[model samples]
Target: MDNTKLNDSDPYSIRGSHPILRGQWITLEFSIIIKTYYTDSTKVEYRDLENQRIQNIQGLEDILNSEEIQDSEKINVFTNRLATLKNRLDVLEDLLKTFYLDTSFLDHVKKVRKEIVNEKG
Candidate 1:
């Protein structure tokens, strides 16, 4: 894959999921994501996001523990920024989930869905 961001317009767009396929890629017309793991670049991006998320969480924890910030304004600033960082962390989580939608990630979800439907049936 090209050394670029994995956006909608990335190599996957042009390859049409070629790089994401499993087994004999050339022989298969289509492949499910459950049959594959995260690509090299995708894994790299995931790690980067994870690292950022950890750092942000640690910073927020530090701010909460700090005794000097008893004022509301500074507390509000930290809290607000913490909320934004939490949002970003959530997005990163969902991005990883998106990447693993076809793998065991969705399998467990599908199993639960099936159980729910069966109960209704």
Candidate 2:
């Protein structure tokens, strides 16, 4: 018998599972797109809102702690602005979670998902 092996050059033999690999790539691309959208400075307004909230919080703290009597109107305005900022940030967070559903960022979650699904089930 000849020593040559059959199907050595087959793409399927070399590539393992093509469909599974393709699915992984598509998921990765989608995850990257969502992460880009979440972090994009120009499109997302969370950065500014967060900064404004921090400044307002600090200013409010200072005003409240001062020896002089603080203006009630200013306190009310600051409280209202803080509440609005928090609501906006919460909404942005929920949107981000809905879009970026990949768990690869957390190694433990990735491991658990892979193990649970891949094992004897």
Candidate 3:
């Protein structure tokens, strides 16, 4: 579907003494498609944050489960870190519902990812 067509309001707009059947058809079709993948922009950000937290927890868990680690205190530390990360993820998920979807936020994320890749090179 064309982005322009998705963004058009004329076909979806209701303004006439007699209802436009074509316009209603267009609007109904558009609404169905839009609703299927329509996550609030804030939810997307929250998802990213959640994924990051899960990655961190997995890393910590791997370290804790390693046979090379003989120190019980060190394992405890890793467990604590994972718990803290889970808490942070919960907070982000809660805030996701309140976030506005903005292009700039996504651009910033992309730039940060690029920087990380560059630094690793």
Candidate 4:
């Protein structure tokens, strides 16, 4: 998606003409993938990923709030951040695919579950 063509006035500019279902589906998939990192060891990695996402969001906010940068420059920065986010999302999708393809992922899940049960018992 070319952010240059985005209409700043249009509320749907970010997702373009895509339906609400597209956003919802992304959210659902992201949520499911995040849940896979529930184990204590993986939680740190998840937090790091999450922090990077938040930093990108903050970068957008900073760009928006800056008075010195021209609107055109802001749009360019926004476009870069958007691309970064999209790339990260693609990475998550790839991870999800790997999770499904490799049975070893189940072993990690089982180990986490055993740890939880041990703590509870």
C-alpha lDDT values of all predictions:
0.47, 0.45, 0.48, 0.52
Mind giving the per-residue lDDT tens digits that candidate 2 earns over 1-121? 3222333333334233456444454445444433433344123222335443223333444555565546887777766765664465445435535444545653433454356346523
| TM-score, cand. 1 | 0.40
Clash tally for model 2: 0
Best by lDDT: 4
Pairs of colliding residues, candidate 3? none
- The sequence of per-residue lDDT tens digits that candidate 1 reaches over residues 20-121 is 642234222112221221121122222235553223444565777789799999899888886775575345445545554356645654564456347535
Q: Global lDDT for candidate 4? A: 0.52
Q: Which stretches of candidate 4 lie over 4 Å from their true place?
A: 1-45, 48-51, 55-70, 101-121
Question: Model 3 off-target regions past 4 Å?
Answer: 1-55, 100-121
Arranged by TM-score, best first? 1, 3, 2, 4
List the candidates ranked by lDDT, beginning with the highest: 4, 3, 1, 2
lDDT string, candidate 3, 5-102, tens digits: 45454554444223554455544443332222132212222223555323344466668777977888888878788688657544543343234244
